[model samples]
Target: MNKIIYIGMDVHSSNFTLCSFEPGYGMSEDKIFGQVQFKDDLIKNTAKYICNLKSQRKDIDIVCGYEAGCLGYVPYRELTRSGINCKIIAPSTMAVQKGGKKLKK
Candidate 1:
C-alpha cells in the first residue's frame, strides 16, 4: 500500500493550525505543516497546500481530520466536495494511545 500523509488540524473561527505525519516516517509524532487564515479563499488555500505536499511526495496520499466544532459541518462538506479526504472526529470520541504522553506515568 502507498504511504499516507495524515494531516491533523486545530481549527478556529479566525484561523487554523495544520500538522502532518507520514505513518512510515518512523515513530515521531506529527509535525507542524503550517497555519492558514479563515477567509474567502480558505477552501482554495487549503486544497493548494495539500496539492503542494502531493507534488513534493507523489508516493503518498493525504487523509486529513479535525474535531467538529462551532463551524459545524460546512467545512467537512465543502472539503469533501472539493475531492479532499477528510473526517470529523468528535472530541469526546477522540482518545490518546495507551502509551501517549497524556496517558503515561
Candidate 2:
C-alpha cells in the first residue's frame, strides 16, 4: 500500500495551497488548486489529485486540515463525506501570524 500522507492546506477565497508530508520525510512540493465556486468540481478533483499522488500504493490514508474561516464547515463536511479525514481549525486560535512581516504558519 502507498504510505499515508498528512496534508496541510492554506485556504483562501479563490484557491488553496497544499503541502504533503510523509511520516519519515519532509513535505513535498506545494500544489495549488483553484476554486471557482464552493462545493463544485474542486472537491472531486482534489480527491483525484491525492489519489494520483499515492497511486502506486494499494491504499492511502489522508488526514487534512485547513484554517477555519468564512467558508464555514461546508468544505470540511463535504471532504469527510468523501472519506477524507478533515479538520477545520480556527485561525486566531493558532500561533500563526498573518499581519507580521515574518509570517509563519
Candidate 3:
C-alpha cells in the first residue's frame, strides 16, 4: 500500500508553502501541495485541509512542519489538539545547500 503524509502550515504574512515528502520517494518526488498568499480569514480552510489529509491517510503518519513566524503557535496547538503530530521549524536553521548540508539534529 502506498502511504501518504500531510504537512500543514500557518505561513507568514507574505506567502505560504506546503511540501509533502513521502518515504522511499526521493526529493525530486516531493510535492508542493499548496503555495499562495496568506489570508488571516482562511484559518478554517487550513484546518480543514489538515483534517482532510488525516482522514485520507489513516495508514500513514501525518507529520506537520511550519516555520516559526509572527503567527505564533495557535495553529500548531490546534493541530495537536486534533491529534496531528507537528513541529515548528527554525527557518534560520534550514539548510539551503543540497549536498554536505546537515540539518539540526
Count backbone overlaps in model 3.
0
TM-score of 1: 0.73
What lDDT would each prediction earn against the true structure? Answer: 0.71, 0.64, 0.64
Better of 1 and 2 by TM-score: 1
Clashes of each: 0, 2, 0
Give all TM-scores, in the order shown: 0.73, 0.63, 0.63
Look at candidate 2 and tell me the lDDT of residue 51.
62
lDDT of 2 by residue, 1-105 (tens): 655567776666666667776564456543333222333366666666656665655566777788878778876887788777888877666764466542223
List runs of model 2 lying over 4 Å from the truth: 1-4, 25-40, 97-105
- 69-95 in candidate 1: lDDT tens per residue? 887887688778878899898776766
Candidate 3 off by > 4 Å? 1-10, 25-40, 98-105
For residues 60-103, what per-residue lDDT tens digits would candidate 3 score against the true structure?
66677887878788767876777767788887877666785545
Q: Locate the minimum summed-lDDT window of 10 residues in model 2.
A: 30-39
Cand. 3 Cα-lDDT? 0.64
